[model samples]
Target: DTSRPTDLQRLIDGIIDDLIALEAPISGFFEDVDQLKRLRHSEANDYYQQVYGLEQRRQAYLSRLRTQFVTRLGIRTEQLMRENEQRRESIRRTTYGRVEDCIQWVRSRLEKLSAMEFVEDLEQLEGMFEEHKVDNHEIQDFRQNVDESIARQ
Candidate 1:
């Protein structure tokens, strides 16, 4: 929070401390250059480890983000598909109801209606059924009845 040093501030403070320690004379005069080399090498190794750890954390974050996104997308897609299927079924039922009602209306007036009017109504009903890709056994039976009535007439 406000009391704690930010990561950047902490890094800056750490570097200042490291520089002071590195400048301090370990020996009386002109200390071994090898000791200096080793110190710098250790610092570089520590930085590399830090960078590697940050990289691993970055990769893990991305993996988790991708998984969550895919899961949400899949859930949404499945929900839409279910909605689409329900609408399709509702339309199917409605189409069948309309076709059935029309067939009944035509059959009620079949004897009184002229052959032309009966044929027109049947064609309209057939078109509705065909448009919805349906196969109604009643339609076929009605067709036979129409044919027999026309022949009798």
Candidate 2:
């Protein structure tokens, strides 16, 4: 195999194809992690679980590849898998930070609402929600509560 250049080239091509196939799932996992930031709070947990499942699958596949393929092929697949894991972890941290910020913003808005004049506070809260693009059932329910309180006043 070493003396025959064509046979060696064919072996390299097969290894390259296997490497590309392995990378496809990693790319998909990256996309899923990136998308977590865009999802609403209500949808985040389910999406996170799905992504976590994918990560588990990817880890299992990588472990198999490391043992069965990388060792025999003399490839750098382990390094690539490690880098992907790092990227996934970084994205997860960013997603959690964003979710925490959203929660804090909602809490602060509610606190401000409690201390302000009714009509003015309602308008301000509405504006804040609109500006932040926070359209969720919880915020809507809060707005409805405020409106009912205003009507009673």
Instruction: Report lDDT per candidate.
Output: 0.43, 0.56
Shift in Å, residue 104, candidate 1: 0.7
TM match of model 2 to true structure = 0.32
lDDT of 2 at 59: 58
Tell me, by TM-score, which candidate is best. Answer: 2
Native-structure RMSD, model 1: 34.6
**Model 1 over residues 14-87: C-alpha lDDT tens digits?**
55344334322321111243233235444443443344354345434433433454343332345435634664
- Tens digits of per-residue lDDT for model 2, 1-153: 234545654565566456547556755764565465445346554554575566556556646555555555555556557766775676566556545555676788888667755455787978866755654644664443344334323
Best by lDDT: 2
Q: Considering only N, C-alpha and C atoms within 3 Å, which residue pairs clash in candidate 1? A: none
Q: Which segments of model 1 are wrong by more than 4 Å?
A: 1-76, 113-153
